[model samples]
Target: MIELAAIATEQRNPRSRHIDQVSTEEMVRIINREDHLAASAVEAIIPDIAKAIDLISGHLHDGGRLFYVGSGTSGRLGVLDAAECPPTYSTGPDLVQGLIAGGESAMFRAREGAEDDESLGKKDLLDKGLTEKDVVVGLSASGRTPYVIGALTFARQRGAATIAIDCSPHSPVGACSDIDLCAMTGPEVITGSTRMKAGTAQKMILNMLSTGTMIRLGKVYGNLMVDVKATNHKLEERARRIVMTASGCSRDEAIRALGQSKGQAKPAIVMLLLHISYEEAQKRLQAADGFISRTLTTASTEKGIR
Candidate 1:
């Protein structure tokens, strides 16, 4: 029988027993205490995370895709971040892709033993036609998931840039990748249960990495999501408010500009900033590559030159 076939596949920390029989109130307090360790673990890895960011930002600036590969909770986190990119920053879905171990089917229901197959990991990446220009980020809390390790190894063979995220500083996942982020959250309250503190740290790091990249890509302006897509009612209202808040215009004026720009927050902002017609605003934005700062800078520069 496969050794893992009969096991629960979860690591239990020996220390958990000391608290398992404790009062309910204490259980929560213990969990919360464990949670604090996650931040510090991430704090220790900031320099390494920054290194990945610097490399990723450079790759993306050259027209490369940022691919996230993971399993279970990590996979879900990647997919969540990738899905939000389009609506939050008006980026194409193709720009940020998430690959889960069991594919889309695993998103809703857990697939049996999906994370144990290392070959599947390599195939999933190869199927996407990952090239040298693409960057693949493999996430595994234990830093020993066969699926994640296999992906990193495959990426290296293909000359693609690879990054790994794991909780243990001595994790195999860290050793295999070019940029390994070992957050070092320590032993879980429940022993090997990484879904607790380790998961939180991974989520925070992923957010930092992706958010920082978006900023450098010019998706944000002065801390605002200037390029948000107003696809739903809530977002449409937000788009109106973004323009109104930025331009200090009446709600009606903001709504009008948003409608004229097809509910694109950045283009609407440009229209207000230049006091120009929607057509001219859009043309200018296109020239500036949808960057609000650049759009505004070019307009001010041109006016001065004239």
Candidate 2:
């Protein structure tokens, strides 16, 4: 009973009317040109995105979690963003989570019909033990996905903060949330194939939301991922490099400091820069709420006072 024609994402694009007859190079050019509009669309909604970031960051600071719920491409993007946070920011796995309509298997194969069952979305949140302190982000390109709407509704009912990310303005998912981010990428190059421009916009927005929240949480120091988990050899090297960059120490000194700080780049930098023991660095970092810059500044001020 939904009017697909009225949906901006479902409308036929006149620009790609003859895309089938165009040259291969022309096709690429056309798609690339259309992709450019995705950034502009996201730029137009900066204020809403900022508000969502602040809301999520505040909740997280208070020991709350963030959940992303969606279906299909939107769901996959949410999962991807959530999965990357732990390695990138050294956050716990429980901090940010992603829920899809058809569950984990849907991430591989398409579960197109599962998006219609609204109850499934609510069930997924319940399984996660969602609480009032958490934040839920709903992703739906068309803005009318029952799965996302249901998730947002349940989140609000549980007294949790809710945010919506969609491509259509004044969407149903948006209406159910506290903050709405509509990028309005318009009709896709392939008419209704939202996985193209809409997906890009969603990815960009998700990147901003997660990255901005992490930065505000002090996971970043001078644009470096100070809390990076050095699980792999490459990441270990990167951690040493990050320590060297942040503390202006030599490679050997950086490695020594990282070893002293148990391979933690933030405390390693703090140890080298403040000429303090690993335990003192840890205490200072804790006192500064894990902000490396703040810890260094406080140490310097205390030294001056003494």
Candidate 3:
């Protein structure tokens, strides 16, 4: 095992040395103040994050898949982000996937020992049928987790694009990846508790990568999730509202268009705005590669619609 004390994430914070001696309010304030550093650390790595986003977006545009591999809190965050992509951007389940060291059961509780087994990482990724067209993201706060390092190494050997997100500098994970987003969040307030600042930084970067890629793929329309899946009552309502917001139409008009488009927000909005049939709107969207902005602009110029 590595000497945890040598890791940046496991080091003690100078500001919080006496946290246990302080009052509850003081302790809370100390933690919150230190937490502010996480955002700055993430901001410092925006260029690297952008590179990963573009690579992933290009791969996905070419029908490639995205995979996130990690352990503990890092793994859970990746899984949460991947699971939300389907509902938010109406993507397929296979579009973005998350793999933890100890499988699904590890998500609910700690699987500390699983992270030490490097072979399991490669096995998990191989089971997913990873290919050259795919992109794999490795998440590890310390950037030395055997599981994450193994996955990234295997991904590179398979000719896939690999990205590493970590909170420590000069990370081994970074060395094995095509793009390394090392957000130096410094030491944790609680000392070695990376689930605090490190986890927050990872979550922020993951959000950017996934959200930016989706936007590039035309899942968003003017800041709204036009491709959101209306699988539940709340989402259905959101779909209606999105149509209304995008088309500048009345609630009734939006509802009617949504019904015509089978509850799809993008088509419904396009149909209402272009005053076209649902079938025509769908064709335009398909021709535009699912980009509502481009489809509407092309229709306006060619047919003088809207």
Candidate 4:
């Protein structure tokens, strides 16, 4: 079957004629206009996004990780989303993973003709020991990338929950996955240059997926990032500030407790809130399922607080 994305590429739009001749201001306007459509495309798919999120929340509660697979621009977007989860949610490296076609080498230099190989996708999933309990999200702008479709098919065979994110409805990728999130971003400004509009839509949707999943996993408290890891100097500083702000501790007190906890933001927050030593705070957190809010509330009541 001819893929919609490939067919789109074969299309000719008069608006695209002499695109090279457009003035700088007109080019920016046209691009911006096309970009604006991305939001509407995303908005139309919020129900699908929420469905995926609910599934992810349930999977994580049962100790499953989130998995993403893609090729080309879609692959890069998946990788980008997976990379942000750890710092954003204090999750271990295993909690969120992204696999790109052609492996890690494809991240920089495009591996010519690699995305067309379906076996490569199947092998990549098998290499990862993809299990029935995890979630698999395949990203492809055209919704029919052989690689993505193959991965989705393999995921179903393994009993994993499957999802497809693509730009076309009734796509081969959509047919294979359990959940399909099709966002129609229309023709690209540059006429079938999916790296433009479709790519942007996919990136936006993935961002929403990961962010929503993290929030459901309790990574966010109100509007604050409550589970961020203090892994670097700047992050350590931000952790101190967040702890200080959350527990209303003095700078010295927050810094001391943060040091006591070895720069672990959540434990230090508990330490300040409960006025407990770091070790006690650590034990409390472990007992409370690692939620700082719950740990602090329990400790405060145990100590006869309001």
Best by lDDT: 2
Please, what is the TM-score per model? 0.91, 0.99, 0.98, 0.91
The TM-score measured for candidate 1 stands at: 0.91
- lDDT by candidate, in order shown: 0.82, 0.94, 0.94, 0.83
- Residue-level lDDT tens digits of model 1 in 151-211: 8889889888899988766566778788988887767787556678888998999999888
Per residue, candidate 2 scores C-alpha lDDT tens digits across 73-171 of 999999999999999999999999999999999999999999998888889999899999999999999999999988999999999999999999888
Query: Residue by residue across 161-198, what tens digits does model 4's lDDT show?
Result: 99999987778888998789998887777776778888
List of clashing residue pairs for candidate 3? none
- Clashing pairs in model 4? none
> Could you report the Cα RMSD, in angstroms, for every candidate shown?
3.2, 0.7, 1.4, 2.3
Residue 235 error for model 2, in Å? Answer: 0.3
Off by over 4 Å in 3: 304-306
Q: What is the lDDT, from 0 to 100, of the residue 44 in candidate 3? A: 91
Clashes of 3: 0
Instruction: Kindly give the number of clashing pairs for every candidate.
Output: 2, 0, 0, 0
